[model samples]
Target: MAADRRVAEGLEHLKEAEKCMKTSFFKWKADYDGAASAYTKAGTCFKSAKSYDQARQAFLKAAECNVQNNVMFHAGKAYEQAGMMCKELNDLNRAAQLIEKAGHLYREHGVPDTAASTFDRVAKLLEPTNPQKAVDYYLIGSDITECEDRPRQAADFQKKAAKLLVRMGNYDRAVEVLKVEKKFQIEGENAPEVSRVTVELVLCHLARGDFVAADKAYKDAYGIPGFTESDHCRELAELLDAYDENDQDRLSSVAARPMFKFMDNDYAKLARGLQAPGGGEGGKKKKAALLDEGIEEGMEKGQLENQEVGGEDEDEFEGGLC
Candidate 1:
């Protein structure tokens, strides 16, 4: 009676709006159940009167009255609220179960993918005690949708799974997971899926430490702007022809090959610490660092005056290892 009296007093001004909504709701009754809405309005009025528990109970009754009417959306929302209430009461397991009910209803309504992903959120609450179960949910999250509907969906979930697999040392499976992300299984031959798959395939190849395979993959990935700039591709390029900083003689001698420019390899700074001193690897590094700075400084002397040979072809360093 107290809750009802508060609701009545709070809604004294909006009785007409409430009736209009009730009628509108009835007119759309077949598509959406409008009968249980009385409790919803009463709950709103109770909430406005600061009677929170009473407001919550009214919403619960509204949900109960509608669940028999097949209004899955309202039932789902009820589960969500029940879970919220359970959380405030510090009943975590019951709270998790309530959220899970909403997740299940979401699946029942032609949105299995969204449901599976939603379940992942709840699964996280249980992951510390149940990681393998989390992995199971993660895999299911990947499988609930067609690769064609939201094509990147598979890749996104699979990539997450692959990280877990990496922790498990399932490298082969991880690569395979990456491969699945490369495809549009339902797409036609001329579709963009082919190009997208090619980029994904490149990432898989790079993971295996095969430079030749990576080179081919890089070619494909480079065609896609995001892939080309990715850390994975850049790291693979570094490993394919990693320079030996300890071998300065080889680095500076006539047979020494030119290396990637500093801008191209961000690690050029760290690699400096490993080089031969003075001339061999070490001297070449100092020389390189000095030249880098010299080139940057504003010089009073002209290029011709500064050149021992020319700015580009100065005598290479020879003896600074010790």
Candidate 2:
């Protein structure tokens, strides 16, 4: 009964807010500030009465009024509140959308930190049920932080996106995200992180059966200070060599190393799944092709040598005619 009474009171406030929006001879303005305030009160009352849908609608109205009043920060806050109400109603999709709108509003209001945080919240909310959407929000968060000159924060968000992609079995996209993360780490003078990301890039390439790309990723790390001496470089070298030699046993052994086990869960799983290229029929065919080419080249070289020897003998027999 008390909740119903609150609902009735909320409706009265809503009516008053609508009336405030009207213009008369005495008032040229639409009284947007008063409407926003009244709508905010209505939303709170509805929320307290456990009418989440009604609360969400009221908060969204409040946000619109705030926007019309040019109070962007308050508008963002109102949208955030609406998103919370959506969450309470188990409308996760709508919650994410509202929160994302709030984030954009915060960004447009010139509040970089708040905007980035809002984006991060939306990403987290979407991570469990909609990983792709989460990745999109994470990227948006990273871009915002990057533009604000927050390299470390940007790199952190990119790392999250990369790891999520790996878990989703999207290694190619993961590699691209990791590359961006590596660039950020390098620019930040974070050598250890750069080496770590390079190692991840190598593993991701390997996961996709791209041994050449994996080797190139390893070699590219040589430019990072101390990477050549780092354990990551050594691990990558051993892994690449095992793939090149088509040593399945050695590849498995290297992949089973403690370092690989200690990586993020997705990457750790990826490492465990790393197979030597020689293990497949395609690898066998490639190896056989290379061997045949090598034999053919060797036979051709031998024929050339014999011709040269015969010419020299013929010249000897000519008794220095020239």
Candidate 3:
């Protein structure tokens, strides 16, 4: 009964807020600020009454009213509240959308730190269900941090995005994000982090069955100062060697290392699935077949060469010049 009373009170406040938006001869300008305040009250009451849907609608109305009043910070906050209500209602998709809008509003209001944080929050929330969208938001957060000259923070966001992409089996995009993350680490003068990211880049290539790119990534890491001296470089070297030698046993050992195990969940999953190029019994059979083909071709060439020499000798003998 108390909750029902609160709901009725919320509806009355909502009506009052709506009435404030209507133009009248006595009011030359709409009372947007007053409407926003009333709508915010309505939202709070509805939320307190556990009416999430009505609370969400009220908060969204507050956000629009704040926007019309040119109060962007308040508008962003209102949108954030609406997003929380959506989360309470288990409407994650709408929650993500509203929170993203709040982030954009915060950015436009010249509060980039808040915007970046908002973006990051929404991205993490969406990670389990919509990884692609999570990657997009993470990248947006990375860009915002980068623009703020926060290289370390930017690299963190990029790393998160890269891992998600790797999980989705989007190795190409993962490599791209890892490259950007490496650049950020470089700009931050973090040699160890750069090396670590480079290792991830190489693993991404390898996971995609692109040994050439993986080798190139390893070689490219040498250009980064101190990368050659880092443990990551050595790990990469062993991993590459195992793949090149098609040594499945060695590959498994390398992939099971503590470093691989300590990586993010997605990267760890990738590492666990790493296989030597031309791995397994099937790969061994293929290698044996190729070797046999090469040997047979070489023998045929040798035989032809001998036949030519014999013919030359016969010609010389026929001419009495042997």
Candidate 4:
């Protein structure tokens, strides 16, 4: 109760502080960075005080000050934060403009991967403005670029674009990205898009509990085109099938080509179950096998000694986190 009352009092003080800052130099100061720093601190205080609008305004002020001070990165970050706030309020166009500004600044500073990712983010915000254009920008980052220049980063962007495209009824492009991701020769990207690129792969890793390998495979797959049946995708599919047999593994198997290969290992066994001639029923059996195996394993030790098995219920299964 005391804490809540104190918070209320602090919020009143924050409003006074906001009034002071607004009256004071929401005016240019000689040292823009210093002024921006003050505004950022003010924003933090306002945020703590539960004054979202004031915090948003302070962050915007800080961004403008950063631009004035020639600190593009900080400016970009500030706008990104403000854009997030605006997005939370469903003010999409303003959010998009702010995010676009950030992307433009990142591009001006020669940060292609960051710029590319920023563009991807901004495009998402502007989906209502033009959905195709967002997808086009994502494709530019993912495809139409070579391994010699930001290939891995571009591939990542492509993956993100492909996902959104899939939602947009661009399945052909989505499949094309998955099919081509394995051909790039580059290793890792210094910066990555915050969208679907890494997420698709992360979902794969979760199925197998192989995070290390997942990261490597995703990076390798990003920039390469001919690597459609890449080891990463096949292995991920196989892993997912291990838990739930209902999945499409043929494409991954075909894609994992000369470069990276997913052998006839554990995943392979599951893949066989998932890809057999019987199709859906085969998948169901595989899922049953996994569940039975889990139950047996639990009964093997004192693991389930303190627990009781529940009533018989209809078993269900599905696969492919990616």
TM-score of each: 0.43, 0.80, 0.82, 0.45
Worst 10-residue stretch by lDDT in candidate 1?
254-263
lDDT of 3 by residue, 20-98 (tens): 9889888888899989999999999999999999999999999999999999999999999999999999899999999
On residues 1-322, what C-alpha lDDT tens digit does candidate 2 reach at each position?
Answer: 9999999999999998999999989988899999999999999999999999999999999999999999999999999999999999989999999999999999987998999999899889988899999999999999999999989899999999998999899999999999999889887889889988988999999999998888888898899888887788888888888778777767778989988889888888899888876463444566789999999999999999999999999988786765
lDDT of each: 0.53, 0.91, 0.91, 0.56
lDDT of each residue in 1-322, candidate 4, tens digit only? 6545545654554455355345344554355666677677766665665566666787898898888778989999889878876876778777877887787787678666676777777777666676777776666555434423655766666655555654564444554564344334233432233222333443434334454554564555455453444545555445445334333444244324332234323323222333322343655565789999998887775444433332122122233333
Give lDDT: candidate 2, residue 313: 97
Candidate 2 worst ten-residue window by lDDT = 277-286
Misplaced by over 4 Å in model 4 are 1-29, 116-137, 140-150, 171-322
Query: Among these predicted structures, which one has the highest TM-score?
Result: 3
Candidate 3, residue 38: lDDT: 92
Mark the regions of model 1 whose C-alpha exceeds 4 Å error after superposition: 1-64, 87-93, 111-117, 123-130, 164-176, 184-234, 237-322
Candidate 1: lDDT over CA atoms? 0.53
* Tens-digit lDDT string for candidate 1 (1-322): 7766777764552343344344353465422244346656665677666665655565565566568678877777666665655555556676677777777787787667657667677656545655555556566666765433665565556555655554454446655765565552323232344343443343334334344664665565565545555654555345333322433454323122232223212122222322332334544665788898887664634555667466534334343443
User: For model 2, what is the C-alpha lDDT against the true structure?
Assistant: 0.91
